[model samples]
Structures are given as C-alpha cells and as structure tokens.
Target: MTPSTENRPQMSVEDFEELERHASETVRLEFINGRVQAKPVTDGNHDQIIAWLQRLCMQHRPELWLYGDRGMKVERYRRGRARPDGVLAPFGFPAGHGDWSEAAGVLMAVEVTSHDSDTHQRDRVEKPDAHAAAGIPVYLLIDRDDRSVVVFNQPEDGRYRHEEKLPFGAPVKLPEPVSITLDTEPLKEFAD
Candidate 1:
C-alpha cells in the first residue's frame, strides 16, 4: 500500500492512554496520534473470521503463541500503542505485556478490518509502519470490506516492500515468525 507523505497522527504515551479512563465495556478504543477512537465491534461476518483465526492459532499451541485483541505499548524510543485482533509470536518472548508500548518482541500482527473507514486506514497504514519500526517481520490485514487478506513481509528499513493479498476462500500461507499454515476458507463461518 503506497501511503501519501501526508501527516498521520502520532501520539505521546500519556495522550495515547486517555481511552482506558473513559472507554466503556461496549466500546473499545485504540490510540491514534495523541487521541483515542472507538473501534468497531465486529458484525456477524467479522466475528466468524476472528473465530477461524482463533482456532487456527490455538491448534498449534506451545510451538507458537497466539494473542488476540489486546493493548501493546512499545515504549523504547517512541511511546505508542496498538491492539491487534491477532498476533503470532514465537513462544520464547517474555509473557505478560501484549502492549507494544512496553516491549518490542512482537513478531507478527494481524488486524481484522471492520467497516469503519478510519480504523481500516490506520490498520493498513499507520500501524504497519510502527510494527516495522519496532522490527516486526510480518503484518497481516484481514480486510472484511473486500473479503480478502493481505500479508506484508520482507521488512526493510521499517517498511514492507513485499505484500500479497489473498481473496476469501483461498488458502493463505503463514510466513516466518508464525508457525501455522492456513488460508481464509477455514474461517468462512465468521464471515457475514
């Protein structure tokens, strides 16, 4: 995805966390720049996709660690945050914090895009750059709007030069840093 050189929102640690203080159980917030916004609750279609992924990752437990929508705080250089719908990491990293702002051991991040246009854009663009900057090798986007999945790999200088999109029902190959072999067909039950 070619991003315009246009400025994207970048937030400080303090501003990034305003959501936790105000967000209700029904609304989930993710940080953007110095502001936080509510993310969409998945529709029936989207829920099926998430369930499919959850099952796939769990099947290979012990070898690979699977993480679901949770805050990740990467505080090393720039303090920021992200909550991926699914994260695949090698099992050896220290457990506890899934927040990218705290530690940078995340190997892969997968965000299942909802109908919200803004959230979709952030997941595809802003967060990928942050993940790359943190040295995350792979980023996957399960686009609900388009019924497709995109895998970005071959990170160079904090950006992915290689990207591939697999349409719904097609088999998707899980790359390095993740141990499972899967495609979207297994997850169709969650699709709307």
Candidate 2:
C-alpha cells in the first residue's frame, strides 16, 4: 500500500508546523513524505491497545516509557513530522522537549491501525519509511485490520532491511534496543 507522493502538495516544514499549531485540539496533524495529513482521533479500542502496550513496557522495562502521541521529527534529513501512537524511549526522555522532538534515543515508533480510510497507506507504508529514514531502530505496527503485529528493524538507506509479522495470539519479540517479548493474546480482546 505504498503511497504516491507525486501529487501531494509540497509543504515546507515551517508551514506544516504553523498549521499544526492552529489546528483544533481534536485534530492531530502530521507531515509525511512531503504532504500534510490529518491524523484521526483514535477510537476507544485504539486507546485500549495503546494502554495495553504501555503497561507491558512498564512491567518488562521499568527504565523505559511509552510516550503516547508524542510528536517527532522523522524521515530523511528530519524533514517530516509524525505523532506516532507511541514512542518508546528511556524514562524522562521527553522532559524538556518542545512540541516536536528529535528521533535520537527513541527505541521504537509504534502505530496501532486506526479504523480509517487511509490507515493502510499511513500506518503500513509511509510511517515505516519515515521512521527508518530517521534512523529510529525499530518500527512496530500493531495492525488491528489484520490482527497481527509487524516488527521492522535494521534500518538502512531509508528503509528497514528486516521485517517479521505475527498474528495477534502469538508471542512477538521487539528486537534489540527494545528487547521485550509480547504475549499478544491480550490483544485479541481489544479486536473490534
């Protein structure tokens, strides 16, 4: 589900930032692949999924924290902005950050598939490429649509060189830098 950026309106980072700032609280905005995208307000099931992952991270890796809806600078040359569902990093990593933070020290960028028209292109394709290009070590996609988890790592040359997908009830290991094994059985309960 790769998105074609050819017809996307070219927007400067500054312009995107200004627009994002003025957007209503309910509307989250992102700049990916040279285009501005409005991120949909998550549903209850989506919130539950994020909460579940946050609890898991807290239990397995006390030193780390899963920051929800944390805006980040991503993609090649940090030209993109994304508000990932969760950004896993060391505790207090975002203490002094402004609206958007650099990708440094981020262990993983996570997205739980939203029930939306653009979920496929936004979560599955553009996000992985943006995070990989930013040199973020891992990109975790919890795909509600397919009831599976996709782990992407070993980023190189603006892409992830390794990818693995597992169904909702299986155990999934989020590789190095974020070495946590998830018992995904609980995820099935949240499947709408």
Candidate 3:
C-alpha cells in the first residue's frame, strides 16, 4: 500500500536536494507533496519502451531531445523535484543546469508504469498533477498495467484540462508543442 503524506518521511526541499546529491547511482529519490519517496528501478521492458520513444522523438523532432531520467523541478513554485522516465525538451535545454532543472521549456514528461504496489498513485496520479502544476505542455503515460497510452495536456489550475486514453496499438497524437504522432503498435511487444 502507498503511504499517506503524514506517514512518509518529510523534509525541506534543501534537505531533499542534499540527500539526493549523496545518493548512490542505483538509488533514485523524488520529493513530491512534501514527502521523500524512492522511485522503483525500471525493468528491461521499461527501458525498451523509453528507447523506442526516444528513437521516435529523435527521428521526427530533431530539434528536440528526449532525455532519459533527467531531473526536473516541478509542481507549484517548483517545490517538487522529479526524475521523469523521459523528458522532451529543446536540444541542449539542460546545459549548465544543476541536478534539478526548472520545467520551464519542457514539452512533455513521460512515465512508463512499473509493476509495483505504488504504481497507481505515483505514476497515474501524483506525477500527472505535478507535471501539470508545473505548466508542462504534455504528460505521456505508457501504462503497462493497462496496456494503454494516456496523453495529458492543457494545464490549468494545477491540473491537466484534457486527457486521452488509448489502448496499445492505437495511434496517438502527442498534441502541439509536442506535435508528434506515435504508432503505438510497437508498444505491444514491450508490454509486460
């Protein structure tokens, strides 16, 4: 079961950043809703899904880059720090930025659902809220659990004003700013 905010470890943003700096490479931590949570290590299928999207983005939007596991400062007033599975941004957007870069120019934040108890809360709920709160243009969720693709966009009042869910093998248009159509048929092979 996912822990409640009061039950999770609480820390200031500064403290969380310090802890993240000292964390080993294998451990990835996120500060969300004023609590510290460890992100699950991704599986091979997860990595493959990211790779597939990465290649697709590069081929279609050469001017943009899909960065894997890039740290981003999100949420209202940028209080939250998250490392999304894939961050789509203008080429070289993260240059000279610190560990957690502001989400200013981020076109999309992608998350592939991991097989874990907290997947529903973390990926489907909190992440979309955080990204939308940061005014990110799009939030793409490749949900393995449901074998579907969820596209979230049009941020307003700390939430996405629009959401579209399509089953695997369906065609998905990532919408503008992102403006890339995805042939999700390949995603079927990566489903767990």
Candidate 4:
C-alpha cells in the first residue's frame, strides 16, 4: 500500500509533553501556542554551521553552557515553548526540571532554517518571541537557503529592537565576549 495523505490535528502542550515522555525517535520536535511540530531535518550544510558556531563558543566552557537542538520553554508573561537549534547561557540553571525553562536562562538562542514551510514559520516567528519573552539577550537565525545569519537583540515589547543580518565570513560579536565567523558557502551544499 502507498502512504496516506491525510493530516493529523495539531496537539496541545500537555499532549506534546506526554508524547515526549514516551517518544523513541531522534527527530527534533517543537511546540508553539498549542501546536506541536517537528523540526526540519538537518542536512550536512546545517550541521557544518552549527558545529562552527559551537566551536567558536568553546572558550566559555567553565561558566558558559551550550545546548544544541534543545527545547526551551520561554517564561515571559506566558509559557511558550521552543527548541532552538542551539542555546548559550553564561551560567547554566541550577538542578531543576529537564526542560529549557528549567535548565537555563538563555543568553542566546539559535535557529537553523530548513525547507519545510511550518519549520520556517516556527523558527522565524514563534521561537523568536519565546526567546525574547524569556528575557534572552540574543537570537541568531541561520537561513540556510540564503546563507545569512540574523542577529536579534534588545528585546522590547515582545520583539527584538535590533535586527541585523550578516553575510558569510561576517564577524558576529555576541554579548558573551566571543567573535564568531558565519560562512555562507558550507550551507549551499544542503540547499538541495
């Protein structure tokens, strides 16, 4: 038999949590509002940039913390959840629940874009707001298709006051005292 084309109804946060509690797969999943969605599959190009950025942040190992493709629920005024491609916290959170809201207060969150329409929207809109509302200082968006990195800072009124995009090899200076380089070429291979 061939695959069915029917679409399932979106799930709620509780349902999402229950699913998480019982899941066995490794694919990334995220929830926004009440809709749970799967993160876009990472191509080699995506991994290259993620590895590059992570290595760039290696100097902060002692007090600095890094979480790759982890779920973080931003607790601003409301409770919103997101699993950013990566996260940085100068100091990781104390022993608490295993979720993002519990593991740490984010200094920065990174989202690596892919080909799905839903994936792109969740990364661009819902996740950014969640990070900002949670008082995260920076949000970096890596758009694989365009080979660019968008840096967001100075959260005000549920959105970042500063938004800047840099091309490949452009210097990205984060508040965490590190100079990272973002290259666009590596991602071009995964655009397929």
Candidate 5:
C-alpha cells in the first residue's frame, strides 16, 4: 500500500524516530521529510504481486533477502525515511527495522501501485527521486494504475539513467542489482 500525506505535518528525522518509538501498533506511518503519511491496507492482489516478485528475486539470487514495508532510513537521500513495499538486501541485513538501515546493502526496492492519487504520485514520482538519491541500484514499480511494470536502473545524479516500462504480460528485465528477468503473466487486474 502507498502512503497518503494529506494532513501530515513535516517532522525532523529525530522527531519522527521518537514518534515511531511510541507509535501505536494499529496505525502504520511512513515519515518523508516531515510528513507522516498513513500507509493504506493492501488487498489480495497487492499481496500476491509482492509474493510473486519476492519469489522471482529469491530464485535468482538465492542469497538475497526480501523485506516487506520495513522502515528504512536511507542515509544518502538524507532528508527522508521510506518504507518501500519491497526491499531486497544482502543476507545478513536485519529483517526488520531496529534502526534505519543505510541503503548501502540494498540491491533493489519495489513499490506496487495502489488506487489513490496521492499513493500514485508517491510511488511514481517522489519515491524514485528519493530511491535514486539514496544510491539504490534498482527500483521496480508494478503499476496497477497503468497495468504495467517499470524498472528504473543506473542511478546517477539523483535519478535512474535507464527506464523500461512494459505492459503486464511482457517480461521486465532487471539490470545489475538482481540481474534477472521477471514474468508478469500471473498478475491480475482489479475487477471493476
């Protein structure tokens, strides 16, 4: 699920950390710059897609670990902390957040698009900048809104130098990071 920053106030990283320490288990929050955006609940389709990608990545690398919406503190991006929908890290990286992990060991981050406008913008626009700035090698976006998948690779100067967008039925080729191709044929669209 993507986060919505509607009435959220900007909070410093220190303040955000303090808030997270005492945050309720019932409400999930992601701090970007100073905004506290509530993460939406994911549906079955969202869960299925995440699992599918995890399987694909794990199958190829075998040694890499995959995370689901773990709070990550991206040091290179500096000003923001993101809980990407999927985080692929080397074997020995913490499975969950005790403190924000530096984006150094992260091979790739995956974000599955949701229905809200704010969510869409966060996944499609804001996060790419943040992820690239964090020096993450690859960013994979499975966009429900467009019924397509896009891989952003070759991070440089705060952005990915290469982007390949493919419709659901086509294969998405990931470079470096994982260095494998993913089949999107199993993904199903939401019913109207």
Candidate 6:
C-alpha cells in the first residue's frame, strides 16, 4: 500500500540533520519551508566572487567569521532552514552545526546567483523574505545575469526596508551590524 500523504514527513530540521549525517563532501542541499532543494552547480564566476568576498571580509573584519555554505535556523516550524552561499557571524560563535544555527548573532548572509532561471528567481525573490524574517542584519545577492550586487537591509515585518544595487564594477556598502565597503571590481561577470 502507498504511504498516506499525511504520514509522509515534511522537510524540517530533522531531515536536514539526517541529510547532513550521510551527505558526501560534494553534496549541497537546502531546506526551505518544508521543501528540500538541491543547490545548482556553481561555476567559475560563482567561485571567483565568493573567494573575493571571503578575502575582503577577512581583511576588513578580522574579529568576525565568514563561512561558506552554512545552514541557519530561521523559524520555529515551517519555512525555516537556509544555507546561504556565505555567512558572516560573530567571533567564537559556532558557524557549522549538525542541524542548523539559530539566526541570532548572524551578521549577514550572501547568495551568488546561478545561471539557472529558477535559481535566479529563488535568490532574487524568495530568499530575501526568508532572510528578512530571520532578522539577519544584511543580505547580499550577486546576480550573475545582471553582473550586479544587491544589498537588503532593515528587516521589519518579514521584509527588508532598504535595497541598493551596484554593478560589478561598483562597490556595495554593507550597513550596520557590520561596517565595511565591499570592492566588487574583482567579481567578474560570466562571458557572453
């Protein structure tokens, strides 16, 4: 007999932990609002930008920690559990965990868009609401399609009150919770 729909387990932190328990080093997945998602394959452009940001954060803010592909706990029940491309957290705070880190003490989250349209939509549209709801102080999105970086801040009522976009050649200023001017010159756009 087929399992009843109600009996099937919805994606949650428990599932996330189970996946993490058996996942290979290369496996990358995200749990969002009872939906489990496989992260799209990242390209050179993605790696380049992440490396630049990592180095930049290290240089500017030696006291904090910048981690890649770290999972965060957003809500208590539904629509929680996000693993951003990069996360900047306070010193001594646990950045990696078996399940998910509580959103508290998280300074910022970053997403480097993939070429896939669905990935782009999720990064551009869906994640901001989730991150804002988590009360993360800042959210940075690097859009490969547009070769631009968008910063979201001032989370209130599950949405950001401010947004600023800058082209790849321009710098994006990270607002309070952390203070630093990101240099985007090293971030290269995908070749046409």
Full-model lDDT for every candidate: 0.67, 0.95, 0.94, 0.67, 0.79, 0.79
Clashes of each: 18, 0, 0, 0, 2, 1
For residues 1-192, write the lDDT of model 2, one tens digit per residue.
Answer: 866779564789999999999999999999998899989999999999999999999999999999999999999999999999999999999988989999999999999998899999999999999999999999999999989999999999999999999999999999999999999999998878
Worst 10-residue stretch by lDDT in candidate 4? 175-184
TM-score order, best first, reads: 2, 3, 5, 6, 1, 4
lDDT of 5 by residue, 12-61 (tens): 78888788778787666777645777767677888888888888878988
- Over 4 Å off, model 5: 1-9, 75-77, 95-97, 189-192
Ranking by lDDT: 2, 3, 5, 6, 4, 1
Model 1 Cα RMSD, 1 decimal = 4.7
Query: Whose TM-score is higher: candidate 3's or candidate 5's?
Result: 3
Q: Pick the candidate with the highest lDDT.
A: 2
Candidate 2, 30: how far from true, in Å?
Answer: 0.3
Instruction: Work out candidate 2's RMSD over C-alphas.
Output: 3.4
lDDT of 3 by residue, 57-113 (tens): 999999999999999998899999999999999999999997989998999999999
lDDT of 4 at 98: 65
Off by over 4 Å in 4: 1-12, 60-62, 91-95, 176-192
Better of 3 and 4 by TM-score: 3
| Alpha-carbon shift of residue 110 in model 4 (angstroms) | 0.7
RMSD to truth, every model: 4.7, 3.4, 3.4, 6.6, 5.3, 3.9
In candidate 4, list every pair of residues with a backbone clash.
none
